[model samples]
Target: MDTAAADGTAAGNTTGGRPGRGRGRITSIEVLCAVLLLALLGQSWLRSTLDVPALRTGATVFVAVCVQALPFLVLGVLISGAIAAFVPARVLRKVLPRKENAAVGVAGIAGVALPGCECASVPVARRLIGQGVAPAAALTFLLAAPAVNPVVMVATAVAFPGEPGMVAARFAGSLATAMTMGWLWARWGKLDWIAERALRRLPEVEPGSRWRAFTETARADLVEAGGFLVLGALISAALGVLVPAEVFGVLGEQIVLGVLVMAVLAVVLALCSEADAFVAASLTAVPLLPKLVFLVVGPAVDVKLFALQAGTFGRSFALRFAPVTFAVAVVCAVLAGLVFLGGAR
Candidate 1:
């Protein structure tokens, strides 16, 4: 009687466990099916909604900008990777001046060599700082690389057509902004504001494996910077459509208003430095000074650049650096414009 009762109890337990296990499997399958259905519905909704003219234009512009900028960004990352893999940190330190101020000047001048957009410069600058290069110098490179590079200068000349002076003015204004900011930081910037981990050099790879290191570094930077580039392009394309073209038509003789407007536009648009010159040239109602300001401020301090800086240098540093760079860039651009483009046409 006891054996029969025990066997019956075991049978009851087994029967109860099976349904619970089956219910769990059924629930999981239902959830996965629901997710797949939702995704399909969302995709269909997006296709219908994005058929409007404004959105279509925005999408086209976004694609064009991304296509235009990707090659330059890839090249910049490759150079950065080469520098990381081939150049020892000690070699960089030896090349840069020991004095922070002198190093800052050199760094600003060195910007002429790198010919990529602001997206490419942030990681390279962070790497420089990590290699024990002075923060001030690294910051200067961050500002100057996108602004004063030969590619940007050439593009400015091409965009402006007859104006050789625009190229000269852009170069001067950008360099001045970068150098001035570097000096300011050298005098009063606190070291603690930078993330501690960002300051340390990366672990050295084996000498024989440098080629592998180069490819890996380049690939990583390309992936990271490419994401930000796409985002910035989207933002620019959206603003291009949403902001009325007629708004720029009314600023006839308002020099101060134009400068302020252009500066604000520069920050909001966050156009690539290489491409911003063409956009500025297209704004026929805007004065040369304002256009110059747009070119300078866009490269040195804009929405995208601010995001990049904050991500790399920590929020505290970016908060301080971006505002100061913006103000300096605006002032330098105005001064350079007055000298080069003049107050008139």
Candidate 2:
């Protein structure tokens, strides 16, 4: 009787434990199904809530921004992943000039090859620094890659079709911003400001596993950057609803105010580089200089970029870097606009 009782208890324990564990945890698919079910049930209420003009407009803007920016974002991640997997740091180091200042220029020019947004450039720059590249040059590339890349240039041209000069000014302004920041860093920047982890060398990817490395890198970047893009779009949509049209019209009448406001908006909007030109162009009331400022400043320094920099390089570095970059980018854009767009057209 004792042996039978013990055997039955053992069986009961095993069965009960397995069933309890399975029932206690929820899988992702189940959660997704639950969400879908709730959404379906709430569909009418959701529709009615979003039926207002302001909310509808905001939704449209949010969707538009996401739809326009995502392709470029994807492209950027793919290129970044390729660079990470296939282009070794030694190759970049060999290509760049030995002198930090000269390397800064080269890095800025080299950015043309990387047709991605700021989201894509940060990791590459971090990788460059980690792999023995001069911090100045890597930083220059960080500023240049998203701004002066062909993808961004083409988008700008398309956005401002008759204004070829806008494209030229944008390219020049962005390049200038990048090189200026690089030189500034070379002159006064400290290595200690950057997080130690950002500087640590990454292990080389095995040649046999390069494809796997590329896919993984691309996936990680896409997931991280995509989140920031969505957040920026949401903020932009909210601002569009909150800020009155009269405010833009009033600011546009004052050149200095317009420029400053546009700069602030660029920082706040955090639009993807490839799509920012269209958004800037859409502000019919804003003058060319302010729009130019928007284009230049968005790529160089924005809320999203600052967050990314802080995460990648450390808060200390971002605190020092973002404001300086913003100022420099604004100055460079103004100068380039005066020269190329003939004093803001």
Best by TM-score: 2
Q: How many backbone clashes does candidate 1 have?
A: 0
What does candidate 1 score on TM? 0.71
Per-prediction TM-score? 0.71, 0.83
Compared with the true structure, all predictions reach lDDT values of 0.79, 0.87
Task: Itemize residue pairs with steric clashes in candidate 1.
Answer: none
lDDT of 1 by residue, 93-209 (tens): 577898999999988988886544577678777778887889999888888888888767777777688899899999999999999999999999998999786787866557999
Per-residue accuracy of model 2 over 72-144 as CA lDDT, tens digit each = 7777778778887888767877899999999999999999986656877898889889889999999999999
Residue 159 of model 1 has an lDDT of 68
